[model samples]
Target: MGKSRVHWLRFLRLTSSFRRCPLSKRSLIIASVCVFHLLLVVSHFGYSQHQLERGIDEDKYRNARGFYNLDISDALSDSDLQTGASFVVPTRSNVVYITLKSKRLKPAHIRGTIRPKLRRKVRRKETNSAFTQYKLVTLERDAGQNKRNFASKTSLGETRDVYYKSLDITYISPTDTRIDSHISSIRIYSQRAPPWLSPKDVEVMRFLADANVLRIKEVSHGDSPTLLVFEGKTSVPKKNRKHTVCGGQCGVINIPVDTSEVFAFHLDRVLGLNRTLPAVSRKFSFLHDGQPCPVVSWDASLYPEGLAAGLSTVRLTWGEYQNSLKQRCWHKNISPKPDSGCFTVHHYEWSKLALFDFLLQIHNRLDHSCCGFRPRQEDVCVELGHHAQCGDPNHIQLTNIIHRDHNPRHLVFTNNKGFFDRNEDNLDFRLLEGIKELPEQAVSVLKSKRLREKLLQSLFLDQTYWESQGGRQGIDKLIDVIERRAMVLLTYINAHGIKVITMHV
Candidate 1:
């Protein structure tokens, strides 16, 4: 009976096991699937975020260049310029003054006619022929503030394809990118890019330019009570009377440089970077009262994206435009080697700027006993005057006047007899040979104006009063008054052994 009972129980158990439902197994499977999907979603979001940052990093890395990028420059329309406005922006680009100290080099001069490249003969235009206009941008910083003061904002930009012939020179480029050899720290402050352009686009464009100054030195020594200068090139040990820009890779921006003063960029200001890209470099420096007043210091915030952050990549690509001037005039393969030099408002630069071609014209003049007019080159080259110890100590001499540009650069020399004075835009009306004559009253006015200008520069520098008064009309009138009587006054200054154009700003 016991054995029979055990068999019956076993048969019942087997039936129960078979009856267990598949629904329970399905529920377990569903739970597992939900967990796997949740984990995948989280992983995907994390990965997507990482990828985005990587892309941005790649962008910044590739676009890192040695110079500052980002600006608030406006492209002035013809109407705007015609209206006597420099640009469309209501305010000027935010400019900062950077005071840098190095050897103040002399400027070069051309001993020839100012206009070297004669205008091309006019030709009929084809509809398809494209014309281009090239222009350079410029900025001026205060003369006194080096690392001593910083400008809050800077404004700078470009005007390209401003002139046209057969080609559509009227068309501004879709992309406006600019690079220059030298720049005032104030101008870079204005280079911040607009939101429309990508964060790295402006920076990338800057990196692509060949315009650069070698990190020449990164340290310097200055007079007592003077703050030290930050340098960009040399890594050597400290030395007395040495100057440097701190060998930085040029990726930092808006760094609160400890001090401030006024600074000018020789490498850029005179070159077409502020006017037209003449291909290479023209740089100079100014010394006031045998000493420099301010030293230009760099700020990181004013530069484009990565540059102000102290990134390392600082290489520029030399585009075809860089050598355009050279290719036109020079055959570098010439026998004694082609002489290429820089022309500027410095005494030392003249050595490089003067050419045998110009000297030969000066030396090889023919008799002008009877002629319609002697060639200006042979007949007109005269000594305007000499600059001896005007601004320099220990006797640095610079002879200023109009002469010739022997090289392809066509530099100008001899203007109103002062070194560092350029007569490019009729700005230096100091040349009074044009005025027929000067009345005694005009001479008196000239004397008073010069005396007042020299004595009251502080009044002229009063921005609040001047800006409130309005455009340079007052100064203009004074300039006109001086110009009319300049012949006699200039003669007087020359006779007094005073280099009028070489006065300290």
Candidate 2:
């Protein structure tokens, strides 16, 4: 109030002084006083508006930080502020905070007497039901459990009350038998045989499945596979009796874990590579605890010098093998000179063997020392220190380069212990070394992307094998590995410009 009085007194004094001046000067002074009062009013109004806006902003900031209790100034480092970095601050009023409390409820315990409800029997007209009634029958017996139960029964034999339930047998009438026979005939006519298997292969598979085992003999060479000698059927005449030690229909049974032989045979037939022998999965009641074993058709020609003498393998070093590849031995019926290190095998055979081995990753034949792949500590090459001998690759002796006594020009893929576990990155390209061409049919199958389908159809023929391998799901996993390897092989062929030719020879 005092300050306002002082300003009023000073204004009156100035007006009095101006009144004493000339008329024109008085008019100018009045105009100037009016402009000063207007400027003061505008400045006061602007200051009030600025104070109101700042209060509104502070209120909003407090409301936003109430729940999180976050200080924007502290949240950002001094460096960030100095650099003028802009950040968005959430100011939505609809954000709700909720607190959840969980409590465990104790179970209530109540004691009470219970009485059984009696069910009254009711008689009604018989109605046909869609569900068929089946009696449970045990397929396999637990030997230990049965023995224990038998012992318990014998101990309480005299004291226990003997109760015998009458056996209920419903004999089927002749009409039912006739209907069943008709149904079975229809089923047999409707079901088609596997298209991939030949008549001879089917016959051999059946013989391996049903032929009675005469004896089990272990081979002296290779992995020492057990030889199952079966009694030949009277209907079929034996041809290679004198050649084989078994003198009858025989099967080479490998360990139960060697399921690759079966897969190798199926792949062989599917790709039309018929290099591998026909093999089937069979369970021998007296062998390997009755586990399913891969049984390959026994070929006595593989051992012409008898059981003591191992498989008739080609004696060739790595250097000689490479030289033979360059020479293209026995190609176009052109004989190679003795000086030209050429084996009996044709040049095209190497291509087929390389493709087959690459798909299956069978390193026993070409890369026995595992030169082209990273060998694990447990691998045969690593265990035997063969991997260390890879430095002298030229002198490395090739193992399992097998050929039949009668057919020396071709190779029979025996001991086909293929590895499905090997990864694509670790593939042994050494098997494909010096291989300039591949079989057209095999390459086509791989390119067509029907390898998995063909293998499925071919492998499903053996029921024992199908069930032992956990059915389609398990078999598909194995095929997936092969399919991936096939892709890698196809890529390799394209990159290397390997020729694809008809290998019908």
Highest TM-score model number = 2
lDDT of 2 at 459: 73
TM-score of each: 0.19, 0.60
Tell me how many clashing residue pairs each candidate has: 98, 0
Candidate 1 Cα errors over 4 Å, as ranges = 1-89, 92-474, 477-505
lDDT of 2 at 376: 90
Candidate 2: residue pairs that collide: none
- TM-score (C-alpha) between model 1 and the true structure: 0.19
lDDT string, candidate 2, 1-505, tens digits? 9999999999999889878899998888789999999999999999999999999997775555322222252144576446534322222333222112222345467776897788675443223111111111111223224334444333321111111111121322222243234321001110223334555676677566555454444223323322333333333335734333555567766667788999999898888788888888876543444577787887778887765465888989888899999999999989999888898998888888999999999998888899999989877688667899899998899877889999999998887889988888888999999999899999998998767766765676676788788866678789889999999998999999999999877
Q: How well does candidate 2 match the true structure in TM-score terms?
A: 0.60
**Model 2 CA deviation exceeding 4 Å by range:** 1-195, 221-244
Report lDDT (CA) for all predictions.
Answer: 0.27, 0.68
Tens digit of per-residue lDDT, candidate 1, span 1-505 = 9999999999999767646748787678679999999999999999999999999997775555312222333233466447643321211233322122222345477587576777665554455332211101011221123212222222111112111122332322211112232322111222232222222323322322221333222111121011212222334554621222333322111112110100011111211111111111111111111111222323222222222222121121122112222332222323222443312222212222221111111111111111111223222222211122123212322222222222212323211111112122222221221122222322343454442332122122222222322324543433343244344444644555532221110
Ten-residue stretch with the least lDDT total in model 1: 255-264
